[model samples]
Target: MRAKIVFASMTGNDEDMAEILEEDLLDAGLDVDTSDVSFTDASDYLDSDLCVLVTYTYGEGAMTDELVDFYEQLKQLDLSGKYFAVMGSGDKTYKEHYCENVFDFEKAFLACGAKELIAPLTVENAPTDEDIDRIDQAAEELANKLNG
Candidate 1:
């Protein structure tokens, strides 16, 4: 099976999460394509068995620049029945809706009829072992459900 791991980040926390997930996915013997959602074409999500989104929120209750463009530009793509998972990386100290990025991706994918296999997960600073465990487990489950 194939997977796409896409990310948008400012301080690189989100990117790190994407990379970790990519590594885990790769170790699992899946062919995975990964890129920054900003510079990469959003249309790539269409080809993926699973589109894994890792992004961070900036300012207050708003999307990052890459994420903003994704929703505005790529929202028109036909993603019906596609599977997606979102992971948000943010500082809890900010106090302004830490999971907003994950929620935005979740809502956007659902609006486009994409299937969400699991509710989103969030990590602060770096992902803890527990966070990685959750993501890796979910990813494996997604792979099984989609591939079999």
Candidate 2:
């Protein structure tokens, strides 16, 4: 199976999470590719059997400008039969908006007809050991769902 991870990270935390998740998925025997949101084309999403979105919520729950174009394009695509998962890092101090970008991506993917393989995962600021473990478990579950 093939998976694609697209991410937008400010301060690198979300990028790190994406890399870790990629490793977990790879170890589970799926081929995986990743791209920065600024560099991703809408076709990138269509090319994968599964897609993982990793992003950070900027102030007030906004996604970074780097992800704006790709995010818009994702909304226009028909993602039926694609599986998706969302994970992200954010500052919980924001409370109301913490990790909102992750949820935003999940909602958009669902609207475009993507099926979710796992619930969204959120890390506070950077991923902790527990967060890493959770991500790994999610990846394994995703692999099982696709490869079973």
Candidate 3:
């Protein structure tokens, strides 16, 4: 299976989560490509079996500026039959807006016909060991769903 991970990080927390997922997915024997959302096109995931987005919710429940165009482009694609997942880091102090970008990405993927492979993950800030474990579990589940 092939997987693509596109992420945007401000304080590097989301980037760390992306790397953890990438490593775990690689260990699961899938071919994976990971990139910063600013450096790649959203359509690049069209050729992959799994598409993952890791991002940070900027001030007051907003998508990072870097992700806006990618998000728009993603919404225009036909991702039917592809599997997708969204994960991110956010400040819990934001209350209802915490990790809002993650859910936005999830909705965009769903609207574009991608199937959700797992529940969206939102970290309070920097990911802790427990958060890493959850990400690992998600990777394992994703691998099984694709490779089974």
Q: Number of the top candidate by lDDT?
A: 3
Q: Write the per-residue lDDT of candidate 1 for residues 3-108, one digit (tens) a residue.
A: 8988887888888788888887888778999998877777888888787788887756687566788877657877886788888787787787776777888888
lDDT of each: 0.80, 0.89, 0.94
- Reference-based lDDT, residue 94, model 3: 87
The window of 10 residues in a row where model 1 has the poorest summed lDDT is: 57-66
Q: Give the CA lDDT, 0 to 100, for residue 77 in model 3.
A: 99
Against the true structure, what is every candidate's RMSD? 1.6, 0.9, 0.7
Model 2 local distance difference test score = 0.89
Per-model TM against the reference: 0.90, 0.96, 0.98
Candidate 1, lDDT over the whole model: 0.80
What is the lDDT, from 0 to 100, of the residue 131 in candidate 1? 80
Q: Which of the two, 1 or 2, has more lDDT?
A: 2
**TM-score of candidate 3 on Cα atoms, chains taken together:** 0.98
Clashes of 2: 0
Give the per-residue lDDT of model 2 (tens digit) for 60-135: 8976666777888989999999999999988888999998888999999999999998999999988889988998
